[model samples]
Target: MLLFQKLYSRIYKYSKMLFLLQIIVIVLTFISLDHEAIAELPYTSVVLPVHKHTDASKPLYSAEVMTSFIDWQYMRENFLIDIDATIIWHDCSLLWNKNQGDCPTNSCNYPVTCEEYPCTDIRTSSSYKNRYCPPKTNWSTLPVWGLCTCPVNVVNPVTVSCVQVSLNYDNFRFNESNGRNVYTGWDDVYPHAACAPSSSLQSFPANVTGVLALSSSPYALAGYLHKPLKRVLGLCLPSTLSTPGVLFYGSTPYYLLPHSDVDVRSYLSYTPLIKHQNSFGYFIGVNSIVIKKRAVNIPTNATTKISTTEPYTILRTDIYNPVVRRFLKVTKRIPPAKPFPPFGVCFSTSTKGTQVGLRVPDIEFSFPDGKQWTTSTANSIKQVTKDVACLALVDGGAASEPAIIIGTFQMEDNFLVLDLEKSAFGFSSSLLRKKTSCSNFNLTLVNSYV
Candidate 1:
């Protein structure tokens, strides 16, 4: 019996040791696999938030650079967008074929067709040359001070000052959510896009494309960055919590910023874009502003027209200043802290017995499409100094003007998607866990794929 007991004790001890060994092997294997898995997925993007202690930082400038790749790569072929014009020539006998009655070679019997004096269409089927230079006889038509010539030969000239030729055109094509191509739908022909970065802005601007004339949204730069392979451009903006902002073009947005499981596409609440004359950027309607459960009245004429009873705010408008002024007057009940420079209304919890952020009212954004989003105090309020927090909003211009700009600060902690294919703007609340920085944003990608 004693021998049996000894044998049983030895076997039990060995079994316990084996179990622990297995657990150790499993843990190490998982650790190895986790890193290997990340390595295999080379294109997952990790972004950090951009932040400032003094004032709101410029994220648009950064975004502008990233999107320019589209112009540099894809928009090169879209240089010349066609418009309406005609091969018009007035008779001056400037050349031989234009010789009406003044040709040394009587072989030139071209008709003299001038629209102002109703020339006979009897020669309509002919090369009608109006005095290429108004005839010395028609001095009263003296406005013909300069010489005229069609640089290119026109074989078929109609008797009119203008002609209709529908080809590539110069117009802003804002992409709607449907990914519809505004250009001609046959055989995939898009308008040519051109911009001259080197040319100084001036009269007789070398860049006739008008694209290079002025920098505008989705046009000058942001509109250009479509991935050759992905055919998509993605923007990962840092949340107020300090996540990093990333502009993804020609690269995959494999992982959402600050988290891996959260897919930006899933959280989207879409608002169809308003087809305003301005196609420089995505335009949407703003209904009203609600603060702490109260509807804050938007000043009259906040938008060009009333989208609803509330003045609408569009994306990237310079309306921050006006809305802010009203915000200051309404939030007087909250104990005021020392105002920060440029940004006036501030709140502080570090006033001797107070917190660094206290008495700050929550800000809510209500849109014309019934989409409402509220900002956490972290987004609405920002730290300026060690002991001071100020309203992150900027105050601009007189309230008399319609100003309802939804700036980047207001967009903090939001996953904003600017889908050029759809010609629409969409965003959703970002689940933020921490403050991130762009200083060490390392992008991992497969060497085979850019």
Candidate 2:
């Protein structure tokens, strides 16, 4: 009985050890299965939100003003000014030709003809003859010199005289050395005032016509001083002219000084008679004052006149580096999609059943490796249907099975359905592994076949 009890205890101990070993093996097997399942998770190529750099700084100038000036300059310099004048004349001629004679008449297709005859005097016997001639039309006349008359006659020559009068009047002077006596008449034997009562304190000369020659006592003044005078007096004097005061006299000798500060100031106050002359004296210290006055009228909001009122959205994608070089063709089954949240897809293409490819419409694009993505079908392909299918290529030996990670499908007329879920990762990973090993595996469609 003692030996049997000892044997039973040993058996129990061995059994417990074996059970623990089995549990450990089961746990290890489970961990390995879990790992394999995780490894098999398919990884699909997905386009995620990529942040792009944007320029949010304000523009250097107002866009509206710049555009307006650009358009104005273009029209003025290119389109409007460069128009052919002959074309305008041709158009005018056509319009005149359409209005035949008086108006459009069903009876005549051409203009009526008119004849001219010179009338004979009753004293002489003369005859008139009818001549076939077209109507007196003056369509070749150009309006020059504000006249439509033809320039065929030059009988009376027209003369245009241009007289240039110098504003300088140095000969006229007032001598204040003698008693206040005004002597302004040049044609009379003696100085005469137009106003009577020579001492009435104010005197003006009367109307005196006819040319008269003058001989000055001083031979030094020959040409200009002794000039022939033809005066027409009694003309109304300007309002700016004023009679000299009782204390003033016309004989005051106002000598012209070389550099008189007072004269310079007075001359500057008067309007300049000569152009391109230094109105301010050479040594006059002149200073410019710039008054910055703020504009009182503020510009309102700019309103652009747009012909089309409909709004549109544009999608532009610039891919610098592509995954493959050769052409690739891919077809993915897209779900129903919407228009919001603007998005696009990028992929490569291939031909081999085991190689990925891009498929769109009638074209199939394939890409091998080490090439840029310049082949696009956005502009070429049109009328993309909802729930469309597309495919992309990976590498030459990569699996050709379509892994749908990005898709767009229309649910309604305006609503679109999109599926961006990465559920095919496990299957894709397993396929890639199997393909690398050159193992034969079923590549049937996942969801459809399953």
Candidate 3:
């Protein structure tokens, strides 16, 4: 009787163990199924707001972007994004924490193969050597490089040094959008492969933990979108740090909310994008420069690059002298104030103010397509102090490659689009001219919709 009772007890214990194991398998399968479902979502495009971090503690000179990342447990965080048009890699320094509790995500499993889209192109790129040069740090610590697990190298725009790190596939969520408007309440999840620095980043804002690469590379942040999405990147920079702007990836007809009748795309003027042999920066052919409708003699080799890093438009000395001279000639009646350190020309703020900006002559650039992009006082004049305002143009030593660089201050409240598929650039001279601004995109409406 004692032997029979012991056999029954063993049988019951084994049955319970088998049931528990089955439950675990079912749960694991469900998680896999959930991720697969998200991957197959039909959304084709995404949009994100670009804001200046209002928090004084995290003062970043560059524009701030917002993005969401999801973990295995489905927790998400809107990480601060830095826009980099010159670099190719999307970097995330937020995962530097060694503690698993901080991330709570599945560890990186997929090793970026050299044969992959970006890796292959990066290795063969003209700028590959200069762009991906590793820092002069410890090289012995690098892992044995191989096809299954080689690290992807990237240059830090801030430090101008490079670091190699492995790529990890993380779930990212974005508000899906049609070209014109966004679907405010919907959150679409997509897997994006990003490299996380093994160490903390230096010289970056405290809250800025990631970079959104807007370069023309196939691996730009928008390039990660599903195959069906159009390869277009649109930007509207806000005039003030307190107001938010918008960044979108998709076909155009972008509408700033509350004014849905007007498509910002309608304001865009097209110019062919000039491709540089070894540079990732967006270059455009500038046929001529005109100040106040009077043409300035610019070198035939002169080109213009659109940049977010430079705060003011930079002109080579030769170009600067001629352009500045012409501008002064046009506005000679306006009394010149003490020259600002970086800016050669300055005027008293006592000058009459227009709705757009301080009354000043316009600077225009004629493109190869025979079209011109005009900048009036709104973009050309920067008020330094209550007493003085300066021309927003800087001198970029005569030897600089791209003769003119259009910077952030000049881009404010202007709509710019880079259509990769078309290899074309589009510009909306100024949104304020249309009685609207980049900040007109109503975040309040977005919040209510959410």
Best by TM-score: 3
| RMSD list, candidates in order | 24.0, 54.3, 10.8
Q: Pick the candidate with the highest lDDT.
A: 3
Per-candidate Cα lDDT values, in order, are: 0.38, 0.18, 0.66
lDDT of 3 by residue, 1-450 (tens): 999999999999999999999999999999889778655644435777676543432223333333333453333332333334333333443233243254454432234554566545555555645634652222122234423433555665456566665554444556666545556444443333455563535455545555566776655666566655678888887877777787777774677866778888889999988888766668888878888778876677787888765668899998899888888888898778899868989987664663223588778988867899989789999888777889988888969767888887788889998888898989999888888888876443243133
Higher-scoring candidate on lDDT, 1 or 2: 1
Question: How many clashes in each candidate?
Answer: 36, 57, 0
Mind giving the per-residue lDDT tens digits that candidate 2 earns over 300-391?
22111100000111111111012111112123342322322222333323223343333343211111221111212331122223232222
Worst lDDT 10-window in candidate 1: 77-86
Off by over 4 Å in 2: 44-47, 55-450
Candidate 2, which ten residues in sequence have the lowest lDDT sum? 82-91
lDDT string for model 1 (1-450, tens) is 999999999999999999999999999999899778646643332121222211212222122111111322312111111001112211111222432354353212222223312222212323222323222122112123332211211111112122111111122222111110111211111222221222211211122212121112322333332223232444444443333344443224434435444345666676655543422334456666776566755544455221111111232224554456566666776666788864666765565665544545666767777886666565667677767777776554454223555555555455555455564556664335233322223333213332
